[model samples]
Target: MKFIAEIDVMPLKEILDPQGKAVKLGLGNLGIQSVEDVRVGRHIQLHLEAADEASAKSIVEEACKQLLVNRIVESYTYYLAEFVLSN
Candidate 1:
């Protein structure tokens, strides 16, 4: 079976996001000041072949924990679903 894995990695809430802060400041300069608590993160898309949905999910989770994200200062979120093909 084939699966699509969508993952997001972000800095911990207690950590400062300089990129997000800079964007917020730029927005304020543009007269957009209502935004607060801005955050920046990475999005990853992967296609994997697995025996089943459960296996695919597990593989992706493990990959995220091991390589895709830094568990100390960052957190990761992922979703795995069977790939749908339309002909």
Candidate 2:
């Protein structure tokens, strides 16, 4: 079966996010004061083939733990779904 994984990687709340802070400052300069805070992160989409959802989930989790996520300063969340072919 084919699967798609939607992953999000973000800095831990205790970690300082300079990029997010910079963007927030920029927004304020642009008169967007309504923004209380900002947190910037990456979104990734992966298309994978596996025997089933359980297998696909295992692959994705391993990938995240081994490479995608930084355990010390970052955390990740993912959503998995079966892929459907369109006519």
Candidate 3:
């Protein structure tokens, strides 16, 4: 079976995000001050073969624990589902 994994990685709340702060500052300079705070993160999609939904979830979790996430200052969340082709 084929599965698609949608993953999100973000910096921990206690961590400082310079990029996000920069974006917020830029937004303010552009007269967009309504935004109070901003946090930048990464989104990743992976398609892979698996025997079942459980296996697919395990694979995605392993990938996140091993590489997709930085446990020190970042965390990750993922959603897995069967892949279907559209006509």
Assess each prediction's global lDDT (C-alpha) against the native.
0.90, 0.95, 0.95
Q: Write the per-residue lDDT of candidate 2 for residues 1-87, one digit (tens) a residue.
A: 999999999999999999999999999999999999899988889999999999999999999999888889989999999999998
lDDT of 1 by residue, 1-87 (tens): 889999999999988899899999999999998998689999999999999988898899888988999988899888778898988
In candidate 1, which residue pairs get closer than 3 Å at backbone N, Cα or C atoms, i.e. clash? none
For candidate 3, lDDT tens digit of each residue in 7-67?
Answer: 9999999999999999999999999999999999999999999999999999999999998
User: What CA root-mean-square deviation does each model show from the true structure?
Assistant: 1.1, 0.8, 1.1
Off by over 4 Å in 2: none
Model 2 TM-score (2 dp): 0.96
Candidate 3: C-alpha RMSD to true structure equals: 1.1
Residue-level error in angstroms, candidate 1, position 10: 0.8
lDDT of 1 at 25: 93
| lDDT for position 74 in model 3 | 97
Can you give the TM-score per candidate against the true fold?
A: 0.91, 0.96, 0.94
